[model samples]
Target: MQQKLIYILFIFASVISYGQVNLFMESDKAEYNGKDIVNLTIILELNGVDLEPQTRFQLPDLSKFTIIGSGSVTNTLIDPATNTLVTQKVSRIALEPKKKGKIKIGSVLVTVNNKIYKTEPFDVNIKDVVEKRSLATNISSEMYLNMEIEDREVYQDQPTVAVLRVYSKNMDNFRKVKDVRLPRQDNINVHPISFTKSEIDPSGAGNMASQIVAVFMVFPNEAGYVDVPSVSASVSSYSNKNKIVSNRVKLNVKKLPEGSPEYFKNAVGNFSVNVYNASKDKIEVEKPINVIIKVSGEGNLPDMYLPKIVSSPDYEVFSPKITSKVAPGTTGMKGEIFANYVVIPKKAGPISIQTEPFAFFDPASREYVDLGQKTLALNAFSHDQILESRTTVEKVNEYTNTLLETVNTPVLKTTTFKVKEKSKFHWNILLTNIAILIGLFIVYLLFKTWQKKRALVRETTSPKPLGSVAETEREIRETLKTDINDYFSYLENLKDNGDYEKFFDTLEEMDLEVRKQYLQSSSDDFRIRLESDKGSSVAEEYRNLSQRIQMEKYSPLKSAEGMEELLKAVVNLYSRISK
Candidate 1:
């Protein structure tokens, strides 16, 4: 008996040991530049317990850094050491330093078996931007950076292609390129198109060279002198690291000439306009007809707006649904813009729909170009006539009547016939119904069984409550508030994380919460608050931040500065409202 008891105790101890949980954390790099990305990974192993989807993991306090992205994976497998089943969850978090210094990340916490496990703290060293070293004479002189643009002068909102070329000799020996930085200027938007690397012809020294080109579609917001700043890139070779900088270029943007036609729609480029009716030449009165006007060519298709369709007494025109298929390329912008108008004829007659002449300034010609006027002739028929033509029953009746009139009709005397009654019940019918009833009964039984089994499974597998709904909501609100505070506490933290999408979603939620809490608050209160000096300042900041967020959300070009301003505005608004 004593031996049996000892055996049982040993087995229990083994099971307990197999169910233990372990956590570990590490970073890919110990040191990095302030602008460089650092990868951090956390691994959690569960000896026997299965990881539930609802299991909450608390991330470390990374206020000193920004989280660019986070992802996790969980796997269950047999552990080689213990030869037992183990479940592991691995999480990867990409972070960027907020400033140059020694940033310390606190312990990460995880809850298992109602107990919290924590990982040790870690530190990352961040350094400021280092100046580039000049290349040695041994290095080839063919390696350089060059900037190119299609046109030096363009109208405002006109898209121009800018190319940054990196030329390097000895293509086979070039190692890699890193820390590519593009220029950022106010009022000018840069959109990345493509980056390509290819082998080029040999230089005079009979050495092969490689060319790397990066293309961007640039748009100037205002008519003035817009400068394209120099681009910097670091090239790594077997010998050493060399930095290459391209020359800056200035662009002259001339405003659209005055006295633009009333029908002008801010279109700039070479384009052809066409107008046609989808219903062909025939249309029914008082019914909607689609009149499509398509403009196709190479230019700023996205920014082009279609002129208003001139309304006439014969037609009732509604708003046009506009769509564009423009793609920016190294050569230039190319695509088409389509404007579909819903037009309804008022009376039956020959209706002429005329479009105003479409005009655009041609930068190549240095003058305005007209696409000329367009006219669509539509024959409108009365609704009654159209309905009559479509009435099949009336047409069939008329044809039958005409046929009967053409043929001779013979009159006949009426006759009657007797019928016999039969029994209502039949053996074949009875058997068929009996079989159907049995089949239906079986189906019903199976359905009931399935429902019971599903209920049993749900009862057994339903997740246990971590907290009540009210408690969860309160926790969420607290987390959101903390995130909002942290958003501003760290400058450019949210932007660095590339969390604009989530940041705006959180802001919208917070705004809704504030409005819900202040249900009784009136607009007059906001106005009165704005009258104060502090309120005035807050209002201005709020407007500027809101505008920037809107622009960043919709515009092709996005900036970190806009995200920082938005966070500041959100924090400020919350503070003022709380007061």
Candidate 2:
């Protein structure tokens, strides 16, 4: 009787389910660092002919997560594998873990009339936020550090980007990260660069809301497979400190192919070479004119430069005055570079501005790209005309100099001389004079001693102009309140402006002043307080920001960035420094 009743119940359940009913839970990422949003999608397929189009469902225990966003969509598609047109009602919920640990989303239940359907529980590993460097401690498995090179395979001297990022899943929010270390290899050159905090996943970690914390322009000096050591960093959060260590990365660098051009620059990147003049219509004779040679393109841009224009008797060419506006980007270092040559026509006639053909090894094409300006004649004065003007000037100068010499000639003369006789001195007068001399010297010495003592007193009593951390903080806050900080005010306009000297100089000064007043004195105090208040990232902000600032300020060729990234960082950090 029991078996018959169970069979009847199963038949009734299948009949009510219609074609084929199903419910499943899925996540976009297989592994998640605690900081990222764990996306959960609950999909329901209704395929039976007898079932209702829609039904109500209940979510499992999601009390441990903060739902930042949630939505549902309905769509019908033909399932090729199953060979059926199925209707799916998909519900997505973006969740941020409230706590760190190995956790799970419990089973979801759907009820219709008197029937109940359940979906299996989903397992989620939200890595623990350990507060120490020892990874052997009894804790859940964690993955936080990641490093990536834009191109794993490259030629010798070719440029690529390497990125290091630390994302802590154990913290409610990030406090700060610092001391990011990338192993140094003798065969590689690592140049640090600054970009805005971005969301592009250079490390292939995941497509979650994130920032590119550290970026480096990498160049390999040796040819062959090189093993790059793993990257590491110190990460701090509200309640925990994590030592993030990434997996090691490798780079394959190949030697340059044979048969390179004789004039080929030892650059391995794409580039375009152009040699042209400022004025197209006229080229004045025996005068200086600007001839432009612009070399601009992506690929090893930082190491690329224009070779000297070959010298010719027809014209004299000075070394190029290069102006670069290159900054790091998503791909690598990319921007326009200009080299201007001042050419003076020595012998005027039909002449051409001659320059050595610029060639660079184009890694993309696996060949050398060579280009020089087309042969264009300039209208100039002939050698005879140039010599005619010079001859006239010399003649005029010679005639004037001779006339002046003749007018100012010295007259011949002679004079006689006589010697003086010796005289005797008295002993009493000598003694009195000696006494006066001694008295005067003593007085002068006393005066000098007094002056030195007074100067020392003044220096010792003088007060420094440096402000305290509190004072500096208040001043920055006031500046922010008034919107008077010029660094942030006209940063956009200054980006395209040619001169960034003043900007970087002021930035260096600001960094120095802050260090002298705020960081050196009150760093630990404020760092502890801020971290206690869940704001350590602000403290760490200065660490990363100062580094980038120093790099930009001291780079061989600084970018006209106006340093918007730095300005935003400063503003963001200080704005939250209060309460």
Candidate 3:
């Protein structure tokens, strides 16, 4: 009987796991004009899988339409029934029609957990567009503007995409248009999305062509009806000035669900929050460490309410250094938001670095996700008990530096100093002054004797002019030897921060500077100039060294060995040039 009971429970768990994932893809409508832009949305739902999963969405059919703009949103929620987390990802793609007909949108392939899933194929009917002709004027034209929005109704703070397209079959390109017009409305914040044009069919005889020129991301602030005014563009024509306008759009925004807590951050999208120590767990007293609170994924990161770092007697907290790198996407913005606080330990003991719990409502799941207070456990050590591996750290443990690292640190006087009430003469002070004068006199006589000997030696050696090539080369080489250490140190600092991209760029610049001075040539073709000045042997060495630098700078994997080898080659080339 016990064995049978275990088997039943196992089967029940397998059924829930199998039904946890769902994928869906849909288009704007079943019908469109020949020159219209079709919008596609792909959504992936995970009932209990990892909140942050590696996901990929691929549209297999490229011949049906030309993609103009694309953006995506990823979010997570808590499921009340199973007491588990759910993740949802929504991707939006805008496509321009390649031809007018009944075109089928084939199955879209999405990969999750290395497993493939496909959406059912659908068809869209495209009808021929009729041009509006004016019976009064003889001037002919086939030009107009169109706007395509993802959704006509959305809840407050829920994001939607609005794309603008231009269609022309017989008219020439607009001549004097400087800017495209968009609506300015209250209670809605308009965020612009950037896109690049892809290869598409150009206008020709008996051909209908259109291009998506702009996209705007809209987020409603309140509930009720909202009107997005029509976008317009005016331009000069040869016979008659023309003005084209797109159709207006209206949005239905519903109020947020009731029972939202007062402390609930007005955040409306999917996001993940974390708090951690930038360095190791053991911190030294009087030395700074970084405790960071980071929120990244999707949604309104810029306006979201982040929890504060609670002050404690175990550590003295300083003002936080915040850095945000957010760019516009399908949603208003998507990127990482960081707030790092620098703290110094006051005493040595096991301590807790924590913040208040964070709460946000997920519009899709209609539930609240309480990412409970982020707590990082750390051990504070006395100054003398600090580990050897972390001794060299002087800056704040994280990305930003603290006030203690500033060059001009404030100094507090321990005791006040006042002028002596009465002045007194001392024998030792008078003796020291007399001795310093006599020592200076003796040193001057020895210098004069050495100068006479150096003059005698120069008489036998031929002296070069101040501006002579030989003199210039000597000065340049001396400067290079002195400044190389400073250049190397800066490069090392970049390497420590794991900024390999900037390191290569700065190293390339330093190589060019060294070549300009040593070769004494500013021309771009350094090898040719070098060949003429020096023999083929010297130039050959420089050419080989230049090739090495270029390869290392562009290589996929760069290491300390590569950087050191390249710098040594440059210095060795200088030695050959001098010889």
Candidate 4:
């Protein structure tokens, strides 16, 4: 009977303890030695509690505190079997306290399951800070401009491409344009080109907030040294602050290339000229003969004029039609041109046609090059199938008058008996319609075949899925013996693949009963380090987990047996949120 009463008393005490929450007293306070240095700390503890795990403890605002300083936090785990947890947090500031006073520390609230738990308030004593010598600082993230050039030396009246670029780190936040100018130089002509300018995101390199790139085509009028004048512009950074700046560059010009051909006209690069005949042997009088002139190679073909084709004066020459195809290249543009001309036979003998040489400057070789002349041979017929009319004008006029008289005087011959005339059916028109329909059907079949081929190509070119986040996480979990880098790599891939909603769900689930138990029981510091590290930007929902662990002692309220279920629930929630 006595042992039974002792058991009953033990049960009663356990129930009372579980029903109560603990609120620790003023646990942390600090002092600074200068206007830039500050120190502070806080600690909270809970015993026999049944509140939700994902809860946050609110603290007082320190807006009066000037100049931010560094801070640190720590946490400890007590007895896991009893669900008892303890937490300690520490922070340091780089500013002296405004005035000495007894400040009231704010209350902290926590939730376990669905019930809310609260902590009692504490008093903080602030004292005067000592003075120090070394406290100077500055912000080096300023805006500025820069410039660049492609080539410095070119002949007078020669074309050159120029490039200018402006860069800044804070361009997106900048507003208003002011005093924009470019370097001024003599005998130089400039024209603007097209390109888009935009603000620099974090993905871009350096601290540049924004950048503008401009391109121009320039030509020099005379040979001499010329300076590109400085440029000035203004931009507003914040509400009222604005900044201005300028930049400059230089160039050198030389005389035009000597011995340049009259037809050259500042054309640049290499070329070749060739001629071909439509007929190799004899041709009938008045028959057309084609003189095909082809120019092939690399050059500025637009600026270069085709050399005139010269022949005997008696020959009938038709105007030439020129066609070209241009393709862009690293060194410059390279393409080809074909000029076609029709020549009619005049005299009945061998006719020789010649194509003269053409010259252009080779920019890559820095020298002038010429394409040699080409010659073509043609045979003219004397008097063959092509001939003038043989009938005399008087005879032709007499025959025309006779036909008109016949038409005016109608024939009046009468037949006694005549069989009824029968009309024949027109099969030629039906055959023509059938032929057109057959052609259209063949074209439709060809188009369908082409479309099938295109669909096959698209299917083969499409991208394939590698793996999902759960599969990767499982792989990482299996590699318990692998290096830490591999583990982190898998974790990063998992994080990147997940959407923001899924990420938050995963974080919340990680702080649950099973997850907390798994993390607390592990000897490795991977998950623990991520939770309590200085660089970790703890999400607002998971702030409670961090607050608990970053304290003086580590205490977790979850059991190890419940971990697997909690992780499964988290993974399910994450997938749902992502979808």
Judging by TM-score against the true structure, name the best candidate: 2
- Model 2 weakest 10-residue run by lDDT: 411-420
Q: How many clashes show up per model?
A: 0, 7, 0, 32
**246-347, model 3: which lDDT tens digit per residue?**
766556677778887666767877778898889766678778899898888676667677777888888899988899876665545788889999988788
lDDT of 2 at 368: 78
Compute each candidate's TM-score over C-alphas: 0.38, 0.43, 0.42, 0.32
Task: Tell me the lDDT of candidate 3.
Answer: 0.67
lDDT (Cα, 0-100) at 435 in candidate 4: 67
Tens-digit per-residue lDDT, 1-579, candidate 2: 999999999888755544677888888966677556788988887764444543466888899875555668988876665455677788887776767877888876775335677798867887753232223122224336567665776788777777765444433223354556766778876667743234533243343223466677787878866656666766555466667666555566778998887777676677776677886534556778888777677766666556566778888888778888776554446677787888988865688766676777877688977774445457686546645656655865666477546654222111111112237545665566466556766787898899999999998896867788888776765553423255445443554574466766655554444444333445466466546565556656655666566656645455343356656666675444432
lDDT of model 4 at position 519: 32
Error of 4 at 521 (Å): 75
Error of 2 at 454 (Å): 35
The Cα local distance difference test for each model comes to: 0.68, 0.63, 0.67, 0.50
